[model samples]
Target chain A: MEPRSSGLVVLVLVCPLAAAVLLQLFGRLDRRLCMPTALAACLASLSLTGVLAGNVARGMPWVYHPGNWGGLGIELKMDLLALLFCLLIAGLASLVLVYSYRFIPHELAPRETSYYTVFLFLVSGLLGLSIAGDLLTFWIFMEVMALSAYVLIAIIDVPHAFESSLRYLFMGALSSLAILLGVVLLYGAAGTLNMAGVLGVVRAGANGQATLALALCSVGFCVKGAQVPVHFWLPGAHSAAVTPISAMHSGLVAKLGFYGFARFIFFVFGTTAAVGVLKMTSVLQWIGALSILYGGIMAILEDDLKLMLAYSTISHIGFMLLGISLLSPAGLTGALFHLLDDGLAKACLFLCAGIFIYRDGTRSIQQLKGIALRTPLTAAAFTLAAFSLVGIPPTSGFVAKWYLVLGTLQARRPFFAAVMIIGAMLAAVYAFRVVFYMFFAPERSGALQMDDVPPAMLAPAAILGAGTWVLGIAAIWILPHIQRFVASLVS
Target chain B: MSQALSYFNLTVAFTVFIAGVYMVATEHNLLRKLMGINLCGAGVLLLAILTGFVRRGQQLADGTVAGTNTVVPAMQWLAVAGIVAITAITAVGLALARSHKRVFGTMDLDEKRNGVKQAPPQSTPNATEDRR
Candidate 1:
């Protein structure tokens, strides 16, 4: 069992990494093998995550220590929550891999080698990040994730990709510095870097040093999370990447920031220290509120399809953070649920957007009229995803919004509830505008017949799009289990 | 001597940090910003090293005075840090060179944006109606 658990952890990580190397090797031998090889590797990791999730669910949180250092080894600790997030990371990457089968050669061409390689590196980094049990390893894996993301964005061979990737790299470095300093400060205060040890110190009413560490960590994570003032780099970076890369960045990578933030801030620092001593919860609440309004307004004003989706990522993640900041059980559950919901919904939307661009070779929304007539299934997926984004009933977006509203009311911040409602309305405005124009608006005269993307791409989009409804209905059962998890975590 | 070394590290770390912040905030030059980031990273690494020092009398499990008596080599940590930093810097540097050479047709660090760049015609079709 020991060998198996450790092997499972290493396998979960090494699968994608090995595939990255093999994909490069295979691509050199036969270009056609790249997609299948990449998909197989991602699927292997996904299946491993399922096993890890099962072990965690059976009340045995697997902790694999490579060196078996008595108490201080860098450990891959997978609690139920971490396993849940790992499932998301692995599942999302596998789908993106499927989505990229036909999309990559069409877009990346000769550069497909670097494209798939860096993408697998990113997936490995994200999986490693999901189970990070200490600050040192967390920072290491986080940089792995960030550096690969920078490379992914830059290698897309477009002028915009160049500028945006450079800007993103600089901003990313700043966030890393913040996180490093925070970790150093925390270790200084607590004399240990272990998550559980840090939690012990924080819960014992940590001194000024610990509070400062928390502050630095929040700033760093917020910037990486693309919370408003530091969020300028995100729209540029997300929109400029190729669409599949955009999905990975928006749907997967940004969630890393939130994961580290929650693991440290709430679970380690303890919410009371953050709220009472640091007076941070309210500050974060304000940041969340600002991001929601700002992201919504900007998204509504954007004309490019990918740009609109990029801004929507900002707005939806804002909703997640807002739920977290409420400091209520429902809020945390809602935040976690929204993490899964928004990630899949946005991925589906971006893939559908990619199909549109693939077919017409245009990204401007004005030129995308009557797309529903062109490809009914893809359009239907886009519309479902759009409705999910807008919080329509029986969709995951609605569930997230409902829980968040309840969280605010329970927190006795009725004003915050109002802000969320307003944000949702703004979301509906932008999302429905795209939907209306694409499906309802008249097609320009002389519109050529357009076909849906190949089943390779459409399968992933349809699955994720349908995931919008499945996850919403699933949330009713899922939230209570998440509540139990959050309850245990906070206690 | 140890006290002086600590003070020296503090002063240099902070000086570098501030200088980096100033460079990043005020300068539009891409090279300057990159330099700022490197400076900031140096300050941070230095600070981490500073935090590693054991106090004057804190001893090891074997009862020998720690850190003060003799240095415990952090070779592994340094090596790991070195590799990560070098990889990141190399990647970014190559990208900078590629961008400059590809776009401007020169290695000059100065941006050559003319007044025409200010108006910034929307290169993609119909992408620029909204100002908000």
Candidate 2:
């Protein structure tokens, strides 16, 4: 029965990937037909993943035995946490693909089919990363997602776009190398790259050298996750990509780092007090706080709107890291909640930015004055998402922040709690800076006249905005579920 | 004395990482900066691999695989694969640099930024604009 379920998991991931290959080959023959076919594949996989996640959340871990002839090879393990993240990945992919149907035509009409085909493959890679229980498989999926992104970003016909893609490729490949080395060290130390196997080895007792290896492994993941002090590539790479790609990168892809952290902390190391694991968590906390402050400060100073949003993502992830670092129930819950909220908010902001670029050919905040009057729906959606970014009341962002604050207080880290407040204030500044520029900034006589977003695009943005509201108001309903999931992870 | 030996390795790796970081920070030459990043990565990889070796000869005696286990295997494969991938990336970067060099006749990091030969005038507006 378990083997059958594992087969189902592999099929769920592979079907879209196969579809991606087919779409790429056949895309040029009938450009108009490509989008629907690719979208259908994503939707199908999204549904299957949904069912798998539901089963897992009901306290059944989905384990896929790779092939009937079993060796000590890699297996896909879907615990509740993996299920939640997979759902986020699938959900974000669906929304972004729907949004791109209309948006891509304005940006790249001739290549719309190719764009989405690559996009679906990228989604498959992300889904694979979240669910992969083996280190080697995780690394393979990580590269697939990243390389596809490099292609997608460079697909735009702008000079800066190409240059930025090259920069992203350089940084991404380097970090991947670091991650590889880390994985190797862990494999060497434990003699098996399986998360369960490693945990067993580490749990035996503390060894000075193994502790150092663990630290190295965490650093590699930290680089991949774009944690502070190693986050130089995020802003430039994110802002320079086409907006839809930007949405997927920030909303879904960056969270892989946090997922890696979560897996290592709970599954690989267990909840035991060892010098190495202790240092990693504390370091993660400090880095999270620093990233929050650094990302916020830089975001406030940015003139380019997309760049500002990109930096803001770094800052928000800082808060997410803060929660995870606490290693408490409330902290884990808050982190998970923020993960969901941040994905929705980022998708909204990126889509809003896409609309701006679509209607009027600019992303300069200064040039976007009076945009609210012209595109009221998009303006409203943007405003809602911005408030969510600031963790304003009645938004899930608020719920996430509230839980985090409480968790920090319970952890007796008042100073860190103060830092969270300051980060929130900075979020207000950066988010409202965009709002003020769009609505209240004095209108120029020749601002580009733009139309309201088409229903295709508007629909997804609306759903995301509603999600923010749901996560904020009904948070208690979902909070305990994530807590139980985290408990399962730690124990 | 063992502490000194470890510190010495740490100092060397730290110096390489710092130098790599500095080149990444200041150098505009894409390939040069990439080399710097590689240097930094190498430093860190050395530190990690060295630590993996340190646990060797510790008297566990239980026949349990220690340093030669899962982490090391994955790291080794990852390292080999990483080098191969980075080399491919460098090749592409070089091709891009050569193309730019052909147009501008120089690939000096600063010159690549400052010097822009005028783009050939577009033959078709919609054709050019549609690509965006």
Candidate 3:
């Protein structure tokens, strides 16, 4: 299908790009201008993505080819899958930027301008990744996102943060090299970098080179996604970064790996013959199951609240991977739905954790005794996010997991379904443990009396907390559209 | 002869890539690991350029096959971009190492050797005063 020519795609990318460059140039003029500039860029991109989503849903996917070089020029295609993730990236980014308004001033005051600049660059990278139409474009944006993320993770300047960021950088660079190798191999085998062009070649007949490329790319994405065995870098990196950065990492950055997998699995190597030969889906399913179990168990044992959430992120990523690996319509829909739902809930949880740190200056769950009594709204938001994470009913997590279970049944994978349920149970154990500390634990004598966090910080968490419920209640209307999306994807 | 040369290039690329991976996986020094990362990237870039080499022979502007194979200039452009990316990563990694050394007083990654303990959580000013 020829994509409709639309500038909306370019506008979506240019908003953040322009803002990042502008901020780097003028940001030092006044630190106060940085946050608003970043926030405005984020909101502008969000609105543009919203418009692009509307066009895609109503008509065909939008494509923008810069320089009109045809196959040689880079392609930026915004399909249903791309738009879905774009919405999530832009929406969560706006909230995180708002949260950063207060958090940055308090934590890393002097470096605020640079923080906003890098943060906008990060947003641009992610948004670019979403709309990237070819493997080379995807890899370039992947590097952009990874580089900015390393900087953000280390921005705190603490010893632990630096160490963790270094470790993450090493692992990230290794993964990126592997991915580049895969892209080169794929280009050699397929003679093209455009995803559709490669798909045509792959469908005709895949070769050993294509298989090797697939394996390399999958391994690279797995490392980035934090699937178990390669997941060690996550807990440290996620916990050590400043709170808003942690939220972005947990909420959006890690999901990019899964996004890469979905694009390749469903869009390029999607043929039944290719899938059977690769046996990739089943292997991925088992890995997802292991990650689910491992992350959940480790989260339960973690004492640091941020680390616990980080572990839970690994578990949740497993759930989405399992859904995608099912390769069924319901399964894909569930995975995409979980992607949005988890991003919102997890970002909210991290933002709420930021509030605790801002107020109490402690990350240990034990140190959070009776915090709910002091900051009831943030606590309530925390509980709401936890419920969503635990897949409690009336929250979006349940709806996403429901489709996933249905998908497992559809795929006749009863064992994986059981794994999903067990993962949820483990999630509940850790999530409620934190909640139990906050709401029910005995108060420490002479605890400082503090009001709820300033509205700038609290509102972002509250909005995302409410977003979880809104998504859940709206899933009734949303699921049909997702099913349509899945149908389009599979067919 | 050119075919043999391309095969040799492929062999060297894989060898350097594996050697780099080994260095990154086994090296204890932070700088060595960064070097290993660069080596691995260079190997991949070499392989990337190798891909654009016309295996049969060069196609001249007149579309006749030539005696010598020509490298597509596009791959060179890609290699240049890869170099820039690697340079940026190296700069960041070096800065990180410099700071890590300043903070922990060592270049070693070993936690015990560096004696780097996790920083205690920052205590709130009001809470600490209340406790006092």
Q: Which stretches of candidate 2 lie over 4 Å from their true place?
A: A1-4, A68-71, A271-278, A440-451, B1-108, B113-132
Give me the candidate number with maximum DockQ: 3
Return the interface RMSD of model 2.
5.6
Writing each residue's lDDT as its tens digit, candidate 2 over A1-491 gives 13225577887678679889888778767777776877787788778887776667667788886753233347788877777787788788888888888888888776677688879878888878777877767877887787777778766656566566666766676667556655655565576667778778878877543565566667766766677888877887788888888999889777777777777777777657332445667878899999989999998899888998889888888888888888777788888888989999988898888888888889888788877778777888888888888899999999989889887987788888899999999999988988887788776444454456689888788788777887687887777778787776544
TM-score of chain A of each: 0.96, 0.94, 0.97
lDDT of 1 by residue, A85-164 (tens): 88888888889988888998898777776678788888888888778777777777788788889888877666678778
TM-scores of all candidate predictions against the true structure: 0.91, 0.84, 0.93
DockQ values, each candidate: 0.24, 0.19, 0.34
Docking quality category of candidate 1 according to DockQ thresholds: acceptable
Best by lDDT: 3
Error of 1 at A464 (Å): 0.6
- Candidate 1 at B3: error in angstroms? 11
Worst 10 residues of 2 chain A by lDDT: A65-74
DockQ of 1: 0.24
Between candidates 2 and 3, the one scoring higher on TM-score is: 3
Better of 1 and 3 by DockQ: 3
Error of 2 at A445 (Å): 11
- Candidate 2: docking tier: incorrect
